[model samples]
Target: MTGFHYKGGLRIATLLCFFFILDQPAYADGVRPGYQVVSRAEIIEAMRQCDDYDPTATTNGARFQGEMILYLAQKARARDPQGLPLFIGYENWFQAFMEVTARAEDAMPQYAQLSYQYKQNTEIDYRIDRVIREIVEAPTPELAVNVRIWWEYQPGKPDRYSYMDTLSTPNLKVTNQRVMTYRLLDFGNWVAYDEIKGLTGRPTSGILGFLFRIIGEGHILQTRMAISKDGLQFNRATAKKGFIKRIDTVTVYPDGKMEKDIPPDRPDLLEIAKRITQPLEIDYAELSGEK
Candidate 1:
């Protein structure tokens, strides 16, 4: 039920700078270069203290978390010029858990008595919730975050898949294209081969062909995300359905330079997607050998 997510852009003018920005780091025993790690609670608490934030707000939790992530990067960079902002998908995890809740609410028919299990789920959800810190060392300061939504391996069940597609320019104009920067991972439970075979009346012996596997055995399945951006709008869509979207009601560039970035109207896990990608349009442009 675990996966890795890395989102970066290019057109770097010099391989040296690109390598300097990325390749210099060497990993050993869980230590990451350019920054240090802090527990998710520390980040979350710090965010609450970031401003006169109202806890009663609809996305109070996420707003604070997002602010903390931003301020921490701004602070860490000031202290360590070479630091990059590395945010682990802690909020992503929370949103996914919320989706579980949403699912239960919708499918009450199949999961009536299992309501007691929901409480236990929340505790585990928080414990695993986390956001790792990293420093931004790009030649030009960039902003972007990676989204990793993959299929959880489910024992005896088929692995779910997902991808994304872009919105038209007009649609992008209205929504501001922020939803385009993430992947739509499915953590949902899927039908097992046994369950399908029961209805299909198919043979299950020896995989029918005698020695092969039809489905993976595990609990979760997911797919990776691809990203694209235009002005304050971005898309993290695949070629089709089964994707997660984070649309912006207002519009602004990620770097805050354009002043057109949009605040999301829907902040729910399935709806609102935070700016996971840091402000990097400028940095990426510099890398592109452009002025």
Candidate 2:
């Protein structure tokens, strides 16, 4: 887990500028009516204030603050529907912040237990815990609108991974849009088997081990999925620079029928892909909170 460090002077300056904007009559409502753009500075300030509100300061303080932030964000979004971008940004930040905090606390006990059991130098890296750094609209066809959520691992870490999740829909103004596409880009880490074998033993030494030896330690994995009126399509790819490259795709019809184009030689890989693609029936409408 990474600690949150504050730069007081920089934050103060940003807040001062935000207050100046808020004081102007034209921007009295916390929005620039002409451009229909919410003040980024003010958004930043609100996020900072949320971060500064320590829920653990007193009994149940954290829960209270969390609820308050959620309420305020919901109200803000309703008050200025045109400021959806700003509200969404704040919501993403707050969600990530809470996730990181919870994961950090959870990891402590798990690490201790693992260390005791192994009697070796062991550390738990909450690999999936990330902070949503930014959210921006992505360019897409005129019929659809899209947004990307950028997330990063622990700040300032040398091996930190940065990635983005994209969500797009054909109809942005409606809640009944069933067709959607979700993409997860740059989400996996690559490391050689020899590097971490000491920590994680060679569980198997058959064909899998041989294949690993041929390829380098680290391999990147990426996946994309499309959900439409017809059905769902999922594609997964794995690659090791100049070594291994393969892609497998699967399609599921609305009638609960599935088809695949996996190579017969790699049934193991096909099985893995099937497992990964299983249970991917996420609700896009619920996820986007459009309704």
Candidate 3:
């Protein structure tokens, strides 16, 4: 159970390496820009022209609703590959999410099968105002938000579900866990919690224990990567005395054990985690002026 921390809501921080491909193509513009991308500059202006947003539906119980989208936008873009656009179209994605959430809640009382699946619940709406706030505040690199959900349906009685939780997968799609976990398991370097424990007969605590034991009692090590930085731009200055940068902050397990750096080239766990929790699509334009 020693895994990623659920920051308020669930977001998979690791990825599986199993094979399954997507058939959808990117927009005709080579990279189709969505309103979320456009709203970056228009965020504050949008807020000025904005009104109240019903807080009950947004994720973290609307902690990221209203004026918060601006920061959230920045956080989403910071990790983007320069010119990447927002995934979903329309304005006020968060507002759209609120509406959807409201709709889901409303339809819940009457709608029967609709309860099994709904897009909004998986991915939190990437509202403009909220995006802006996260960008300016966080210490780490800002990244676009996405999520994945797991559903349980019996064979003949598909309605009866024993348990349902968002399963971790490595991809940015709000798909079921089967696809997500498949991707990571394909990665040659990755080893699953269940499989590893089954093979290793020893009473190992967990992956954290494995990491710490390697760093402490174990005696095999080497440097991972070397990125030299002296006069700022290393690409521009070919001739300069660069120094090695050592990372700080030791990782501590629940058992109070400490460890150094984690395994290298182990199929970027964070990205894997990221891919698993795909974002739910929402249209923000529907939320303009609070209708």
Q: Which digits, one per residue and each the tens of the lDDT, describe model 1 over residues 235-256?
A: 2221111242222222222232
TM-score leaderboard ranking: 1, 2, 3
- Which regions of candidate 1 fall more than 4 Å away from where they truly are? 1-35, 55-62, 84-291
Model 3, 19-129: lDDT tens digits are: 111233544431433323333233333323222222232111111221233233344545553433233222233334334445553442111122223211112223333
Quote the lDDT for 181 in model 2: 19
lDDT of each: 0.23, 0.26, 0.23
lDDT of 2 at 2: 5
lDDT of model 2, residue 252: 33
In order, what is each prediction's RMSD in angstroms? 18.5, 19.3, 21.0
Show model 3 residue runs off by greater than 4 Å. 1-136, 139-143, 152-259, 262-291
* Tens digit per residue, CA lDDT, model 2, 1-291: 001111221000000011112123643444433222324443344435434333322211212222323233333434653333322223233333335346343442221222222221101111111112122432211111122221222345222121111111110111101111122211111000000111111102445445555653433333333222222322332323365455445443323233454335645454444444432222122123221
Tell me the lDDT of candidate 3: 0.23
* Per-prediction TM-score to the true structure, in the order listed: 0.27, 0.25, 0.19
Judging by lDDT against the true structure, name the best candidate: 2
